[model samples]
Target chain A: MVKNRQWRLISFPSGRPEASNWELVETEAPEVAPGHLLVKALYLDVAPYMRGRISPQPNYAAGVGLGEVMVGGAVGRVLESRSPGFAAGDLVVADFAFGWQEYAVLSPGDVRRIDPALAPLPYWLDLFGLNGLTAYFALFDAGAMKAGDTVLISAAAGSVGQIAGQLAKLAGCRAVAVTSSAEKAAWCREAGYDAVIDYRAAADLPAAVAEACPQGVDLFLDNTAGPIHDAAMQNLALDARVVVVGTASLADTFGAPDTGPRFLRQILVARATVCGFLFSDYAARHEAGRARLRRWYEAGRIHSKFDIAEGIASMPDAFLRLLTSRNLGKQLVRLEGD
Target chain B: MVKNRQWRLISFPSGRPEASNWELVETEAPEVAPGHLLVKALYLDVAPYMRGRISPQPNYAAGVGLGEVMVGGAVGRVLESRSPGFAAGDLVVADFAFGWQEYAVLSPGDVRRIDPALAPLPYWLDLFGLNGLTAYFALFDAGAMKAGDTVLISAAAGSVGQIAGQLAKLAGCRAVAVTSSAEKAAWCREAGYDAVIDYRAAADLPAAVAEACPQGVDLFLDNTAGPIHDAAMQNLALDARVVVVGTASLADTFGAPDTGPRFLRQILVARATVCGFLFSDYAARHEAGRARLRRWYEAGRIHSKFDIAEGIASMPDAFLRLLTSRNLGKQLVRLEGD
Candidate 1:
């Protein structure tokens, strides 16, 4: 029997996560039941929203239980299948709740076969997967983006950011990206965005976004919602649409994001719309979103970037880094080298 | 020459209007110009939104200037006309921009011919006018009300509130009206609402709203923007729509409405939408809105309650009452004896 090491919740985090909140343990290999596929975990995706999940909320999906494996999304290789489709080395995307483990057992319904031709393995976890689908639907469906509209994307160099920026350009929109670093700005600029604003360097972000876009922002895709949201709120044009996808700003415990005063008034005066969305709600449309996203990727119209941390054992640290915005793009941990 | 006693703005109030801010003066009517009509003001409309116009903003028209008759919408009789289509004794809606005055001089473009058959003189200032159109479009067009959906209207006894509540009910929605008093609650119940919540007495409004509407609120017509807005944010169902029309909360003067903790999370989790709109933007559609509202009134489906304050000299005190939420339904000033 193979021994599996898993990251379990030791305690709830109060603020920034530390190693103490998680405990690593060895467990017996998960049994492959009938109609179930055993996946040897190859990569674990780390995201900012995971922090909100660590603390239990009655409204949301079940959070990480004490001594239970930490919850996440993962890409793995199907080592054993008990169903009609027997596979030995098929790359698959698993929706198994907890991903920071060496192996997991997933029902066929919870897993999707990945086409290896779609860039690389990390690309599936980043661009053509949940992250990319989120940015696409949130901007297009919820935001109601039109071609030639000025788009402002927050957290624009992250995994979702790289693809969103390129997608906006592909759709003939003028994309203005906001990133935390100069390097990420350079990355966003190279991604074909019309303008890239280094949010950290720009003391007056509203002025910078206005100056960079020239025309006011028509659609704003917000991933990090602190000062960036406040700034974008002021600079948005009449009838603007804002999609709130993630709140990296709230990762710090005991303190909320520092959204400045006059935020709602900004929404009022501009006749703008602010909507929040979850990717799971769009699950039925996922395959369609992915199909369109795949076409774009195949046509070289979009790009995916990942900041892979090296080991399953370092999952806790990687997750902590993800919460702190330390990872440039989609934060992930590779169990083994590609 | 006709002797006209008018209420003039002696000074613009920095905060709230006081008796000293207005002055009553008698003047001799001037001769009508080449394209101007002289109107004998009949009914002057008093609305909460007019407070915003008086305060120095880029509104429908300029601010009510100091030492000038207060700007308002009024129903009047054209006493003398220099324009071809206008005739003496014709009932008309005029924005001479001086409704608080006994007489007004208006250009042809600023006046609309009124059909007295469909509505009485007061109807021109209430249901078939700006107040009614504001309620109709804000609920139907901006809020996008659907049949069988649940609607929660704040300030349900005020001018727009009374009209919007009836509109929502007519649209086949489960309309819940939030009012500040027992009298208003009884009025809302008689106004054909499914539920009425007395916000003044309720300790936990969100819980109260949820208890009243077990399935949850689908659309919120927000006029009071403080705790009611926060509660509406919490009680919103997935993809719920919130339409913000007025800020009647006492806290509106300070800054942006304060959304309590977990408000943004509630919005994100519910996948809800919050949008603000001004009725004046739909000026082109005003006639269409009026026609539909007129049909509702003639069919005996719509009801309007007026707190008529007699005389143009009472305009200052009348405005003070409107601002303090002391008036129910449409607050009107009778400029002439009926």
Candidate 2:
């Protein structure tokens, strides 16, 4: 019997998560059923969205129950298989339901096969996974980004933001990045963003955005939806499209309602559209999105960056750092060597 | 020389407009210049949109300058014409730039000719004009409303609300109306709304909306964007569309920023879209919208109700009443016999 190490939610987080909220323990792995496979976790992704799952209240997805494994996405290798579709040594990626565990018994259909040759194992958690798919659909499908359009992305150095900025540039649109620090801003520029707004340095974000995008933003990919969203709303061009992706800044205030500048007048005046996009809704077309991402990766037109924490024990800390914007790119915990 | 009476804004209103904010004066009418026609105003429209124009800050349209005629739409008869497009005794409609006045010399190109026989002369300012066009494009175009969709219209006894409720019903969608009083609620029922929520009676608006639309709202035509908008945001269905048409309740709070519950989380979770629609953006397709409206009117599938205040002198009072929700349906000042 294999010993499995798991991080479970001991308590729901009131604001920002703490170490006390989680309990790391070791237990024997469950027996693999006839149609299931035993998988050894390689790399686990800790994202801003995980903050919602640990909250006491329910979100779009189910909340993690007390004593349950802390939910997350993980790249794993099929150690043993009882299912006809999979065999030992095959690499696969499981979505959030897989949780933060060293070993898991998953059904064949629960995980998607990935080629290690595409990029890297951690990249499957970044570029070829939820992050990349989110950027792809939010920009092209929801925002309806077009050539000559000015695209503004908030949290510009995050996993999705980096890819979105590069994608916007590739689409022949003017890409602007809003980052919290000078370091992230420089990274965004390297990623092919035409302009960068250091939101931390600027006294007035709307004015800064207006200065960067003189014609005003035609498409906005909003990740931090507090002041950044309010600023973007102020400078929207006629018929602007705002894609609501994430709200990392408000992670601490999830239990209470957040109040900000009203957007109705600006929206009405500019004839703009603000849409909330959840990537999972486009599950049927994910392969299409992945194929395009692969081509872009092969062409070296896009790149992925990972801020990885070594070992399974660092999962909670990595997630906490991600929530506070301490990480530069996709936050991940490396569980096992390639 | 004819005496031209005018209602001019003497000061920008701080909150709800008062008679003291405007001045009624008599001036000698200018001679009809070549290429211009003398228009004797027959009916002047007083709408919620007019509140935006009288504000200190510029809205989608320019604010009415102090000492200038209060900007509004008006239907008039051409007394004399020197331009090829217009002739003496022809009826015409002029948009908001025309200003509130009994007589004015305007370029023939400044106004569009209208047929009184198509409907009543006042209907040109109601169902056949801006109000009708707003409801049409907002529901059908921006909202992309489908049959079996549930629509929630705020301020449902108002002009646009009444028409929108009926339009949603005609489209085979469930129409729920949120009004301020029992009387307006009864009127909305008569207009074919499936459900009515008197917002004044509900202690918890979101709960009331959830109770009214058990399945959640697919399309929201929001007129008052304070608490009602907050409630609607809380109960959005997946891929729901919110059309921000007006903010009548916030008419007094124009000087200061209005803060309410932030909608980004709700918007993101539901994968919904909120759009601010200005009818003028669809100017190229106004005729198509009008043709559809005319057909509906002819087929008795649509109807228009007006609360008429006699004479141009009552324009200020009519507009004030409309702003306070004191007037029902489309508020208008009948300057002359129809």
Candidate 3:
């Protein structure tokens, strides 16, 4: 029998999660069942979405119960298998139901195989995984982005934002990014964004956005939905499309009452549409999204960056940093590096 | 030549419009010029949308200029004509640019002929006019109503609301109505709404809506923005569509700051869409919408009621009653007897 170390939820977080909210424990790995396999986690992802799962209030996805393993996604290698489709050395990615642990006993249906030859292993966790699929559908399908359209992306240096901005650029659209820091803004500019707005430094975000995309924003991929969303609403062009992908800025007020600028008049006058997008809605078509992302990655049309913590024990800190926008790119923890 | 009496805007309204905001003036009517005709007003429309045009801040449609006639739609008789297509004694409907007046000289392009054989004269001012077109396009195009969908319409006793609720029912959907009073609620039930919620009597609007629509709301036609909008946000079904058609509740706060519930979280979780809909967007497709509405009206699938004010001079009071939700069904002014 092997030992498995897992981070489990001890309590639901109120505002921002603290270290005491989770408890790290070690247990004997369970033996593989008839249709299951043993997985040794190679890389675990810590995303903004995980915050919702740890909350007591019901979120879009199911919340992690107290005393349960923290829910997340990870890339793992099959150590042992009972299913005919899987072998000991096969590399795979866990479904969203998997936990943030060093080892997991999972049914073959709960994971999908990944080819290491297509892209780097980390790319599977960053661009080719949830982040890539999110950017792919949010930009192309929900956003309805077209050539010559001006696209604005908030949280431009973060995981999904980075991919969305690059995709907009690839579609022959003008891409404008909103970032909190000058460093991140520089990175966004280097990533082919036509203009970069340091939201922290701008006196008026809407004015800055207007100056950047003088034609006005036709599509906006919003990750931080607070003041950024209000500004985007004010700057929408006629028939604009706004995709609400994440609310990192409103994490603390998720279950509370929060008020911002009223958008009814603006949206009505502009004849704009605001859509809330989730990748799970397109679960059956993820392969199609992945195929397009793979083509982009192989052609060097897209790039992904990972801000990885060294060990499985670093997940909580990494996640907290992600919430505060301290990390530069996709936040991850390397449980067992190659 | 005839004496023309006109109600002109003297100043922009701050809150609800008052009598002093308009000035009644008498002038000699101009002769019919080339391509122009002299029209004697028959009926005039008073709608919630007219409030936006009277405000100081520009709305989707052009604002009524100070000291100019308040822009609106009116049905009149061609008293004298210079155009070959129009003849004296022919009935016609003026475009939205027409002023509130008893007599005027208009270009033939500024009006359309109305067939008396199709519907009553007042119907041209109510259900067969812009109001009908608004309900038709807003429900079909913006709301995207599907059969069996649970449709919730706010201001269910008003002009557009009354028509929209019946249209939803005719489309094989479950129609629910939200109104300010029990009288209106009873009227909504008589009009074929599957359920009716008296918002003023309900302790909790969202809870009442959920109880009324156990399956949740698939489409929401929101005419009042303040608290009703908040409640609708809280009760959205997955993939819900919210059409922001009017803001009667926010008319007092149009130029001032008004804060209420933030809808981003609810929309994101439910994967819903909130669209600001204006009838002007479908101006090019008005005939298509009218054709559909005409069929429904002729087949008795739709009904319209008008609260008629005695004369053109009663427009301000009629409009104020509409703002306060005191008037039921479509509000209209009789400028001349049949």
Error of model 3, residue B322, in angstroms = 51
Give candidate 2's total backbone clashes: 0
For residues B216-312, could you state the per-residue lDDT of candidate 1 as single tens digits?
7777777766677667755666556766666555322422233442233223323445343322334455345444433533454433233456543
Error of 1 at A221 (Å): 1.0
- By lDDT: ranked, best first: 2, 3, 1
Model 3, A156-188: lDDT tens per residue? 777667767777876889999998777778777
TM-scores for all candidates: the values are 0.74, 0.77, 0.78
Candidate 2 lDDT over A114-218, as tens digits, reads: 878744566556555566566766777667789999999987767677767777876889999998777667767776789999998999887999999999778
- Residues A289-328 of candidate 1 have per-residue lDDT tens digits of 4444335334643332334555323433543443322443
Q: After superposition, how far is residue A270 of candidate 1 from its true place, in Å?
A: 23
Question: For model 3, how does the per-residue alpha-carbon lDDT over B79-176 read when each residue is reduced to its tens digit?
Answer: 89999999999999874645766777888877879878755565555555554555656677667889999999987767667777877876889999
All models: lDDT? 0.62, 0.68, 0.67
